[model samples]
Target: MKQRLGAALAWLEDRTGLVGIVRTVMQHPVPPGATWWYVFGSATLLAFLVQVVTGVVLGSMYVPAPDDAYRSLEFITNDAPAGRLVRGMHAWTATAMIVLIGIHALQVFLFGSYKYPREVNWMTGVLLLAFTLAMAFTGQILRFDNNGVWSTIVLVKMTSYVPVIGDDLGRFFLAGDVVNASTLSHFFTFHVFVIPGLIFAIIGIHLYLVIRNGISEPPEAGRPVDPATYRAWYHDYLRREGVPFWPDAIWRDALFGVLLVVGLLVLAGVIGPPEVGAPPSPANLDTNPRPDWYFIWLFAALALLPPGIEFYFLILGSGLFFIGLFILPLLANRGERSWKMRPWAVGIVCVIVTGVGALTVYGLQAPWSPDFATQPLSAEVVGATTGPVANGAQLFHEKGCHYCHRIAGSGGQRGPDLTTIGDKLSENELIWRIANGGVNMPSFAGTLTQHELREIVAFLQSRRSAPAPAQNVPTVR
Candidate 1:
């Protein structure tokens, strides 16, 4: 049986030159001292493969129609065999792929690999990043949940801000004026077919470029990339110091890729996929729909933008981002490759990472978005049996104070927590702040009756309980 199997394999290899193809790829020359930093590119590719397989499995079970999409996902999560696991893997791996790709891009940028012959490779990478985000957006819509619907609406609004043919593009994205049955089908087609096809094609081109131009060598001090001489210099360097890519250089990539897959599987089994929220319904005003974590920075930025300039920022900001990316390689095709020597490169990266990270944290806390979940203070907290104080407590929620101010952990963080507001402010000061809105806060002088204002003030004045001592909460940075 073994002899027969071997003979069959030999016959196929002879016909197709499979062994020779494998040998050619395996024996490609890699620069000396290539290290684990080089593993991220391969790891990203592995993650993309994982996404393709798991996504196909998910597609088999998903229904694209608006009415059935949510139900179908629920069935897949709760009833189908290995369905939850596959879905979780897909979700987790998408996140991993994004993170890995960012790291890969950052590595290339820091190493100055985008210079000279690799300019096209860098541009293709930028497209891949955009496609990954597009996939994330369309995949969210596949859930057909409240967040998904809200996101679709917001996306259409965003598209409408595009210059020139914005209206047509927005309509095309929605498959109509608004999200309906066609919207779900449209997203499904793009998520499962169109976007993935483009990603695969781009990946093919990216890999070809990488192979043709060869892997960038580790940056050396004073070694500036000169477009005129870089290719010849690289080829000569490779001849003098290169090693076979197969076992000598590829080991780290293989190890990292395996570990990443294992991590995804473990995470999927332990945590499962994110829960499906309320079904798609515009009437569900109580829902505070938010995008996935990767986009929280954008959400935070939009929330923080001054009202009048929002549409302009939404349009111009995005346009400038892509324009900057496109023009970068063109502007500086040759430069000193080391980060230590490129102060501007280091500064730009630091600013971007810091800005995005800060925004994501702000979004998570959600100081700008209204917290509709704030409930009235309990009788225990108010310490009022009846009459004015109790009425004041009731009036607080009725007056929408709890939406912006937390009293003893019962309200939103959009404004300062009113848990100990009475401790810091006298009754008159409290009344003044309430009657005259400060900054983002709304004034109640006209909106509230005199008696209602007095009652609310009385309620807030009674909130004098001391806060608990702070615990040691870990800080990110």
Candidate 2:
């Protein structure tokens, strides 16, 4: 049996040369001292493979039609066999791909691996990163929930800030003047077909460049990359100390890839997929749509950026950032490779990580958006059980005042805390403010009747930290 199997294998190899190609790839020499840090690139590739497989499974099940998409998601989440697990795996692997690719790029940048012949490699990597983010944005919109729909609308509106083609871009994304069934179909095609095809092509180029340029050696503090003689020096150095990639370096990558897959599986089994929000409804004022965690930083930035410059910051700022990434190798292709010798590189990475981390935390908190889910103020917190003050407290909640204003520490912080409004404003002033709202506050004049408005004023008048002073303070407005 062994002789027959060997004969068959030899026959196939002679005909196709597949065995020779595999042997050549497996026996490629890698630089010495290429350690676990080098595993991220392979791990990222593994994550992308996972994404592709799981995405195919989901695409087979998901309905792209606007009317049926949400219902289909519900069925998959609740009824389909192993559907929830597959969905969770897809979501988690997408996150893993982004994170691993980011870390891999940072590693390459710090190591100065983009220098000399590898400049194109770094450019391809940057394109992959951008494509990965595009996939994430499109996937979020494909959820077809209210939050997803509004998030896409918000993105389209932001796209409208681009200089000459802003409006055109927005219309293209929406597939018309407004979002409809076509918008969903367009996003589905981009996420599943268009963006993935670009990513696959770029990944092919990236891998080829990796093979062409060879893996960079661990950086030494005194060693600086010089394009003139670097390739010859690299080849000579590899001849002296390089190891075969298969049994030597590939083991670490394989181990790490296996561990990453196991970790993703565990997370998917334990946590499941993100909860689907309500059906799409543009008229729903109570909805506070937010993007997935990966994009929360950008959401926070757009919200926190000073009002007038948002257009510039959103357009020119992002454009410049990406432009900088693409031009980095051109600007400093030959330099000290070690972080120990490049303090500015370290500082840049630190600033970016810190800024994004801080913004993400703030976005999760989201103090700017009203808390529509806040429960009504309890009777104990209201400090009244009956009469005008109590009735006013009930009316306060009924009018949705508690959603924006904090009272006794239990409401939203979007507006000022009204826990002690009585000490600051008189009854007439309180009445006037409630009737005619200010900037962030909507005018309740048309919404509240005279009696209900007075009740709300009474409730506000009862909110005081201490007794009023003997001297009467003048009211403004």
Best by lDDT: 2
Could you tell me every candidate's TM-score relative to the true structure? 0.76, 0.78
**Model 2 over residues 1-477: C-alpha lDDT tens digits?**
999998987898999998877887889999877888899999999999999999998999899987798888888888999999999999899888889999999999888888877899999999998999999999988987765665676677577789899989988997875556888899999999999999999999999899889988999999889899898999999999999989998999999999999999999889988887756542343655667889888878877887557657877877888989998898989978999999999999999999999999998997576777878888887777987778888888867788889998888776689999988888877875675443235445546778887777877877878744546432222
Number of clashes recorded per candidate: 0, 0
Off by over 4 Å in 2: 282-288, 369-477
List the candidate 1 regions with Cα displacement exceeding 4 Å: 1-18, 282-286, 367-477
C-alpha lDDT values of all predictions = 0.81, 0.83
Weakest ten-residue segment in model 1 by summed lDDT = 468-477
How would you encode candidate 1's per-residue C-alpha lDDT over 172-286 as one tens digit per residue?
9889765678888999999999999999999999998988899989998799999889989989988999999988999899889889999999999999998987764323435
RMSD in angstroms, all models?
12.0, 9.5
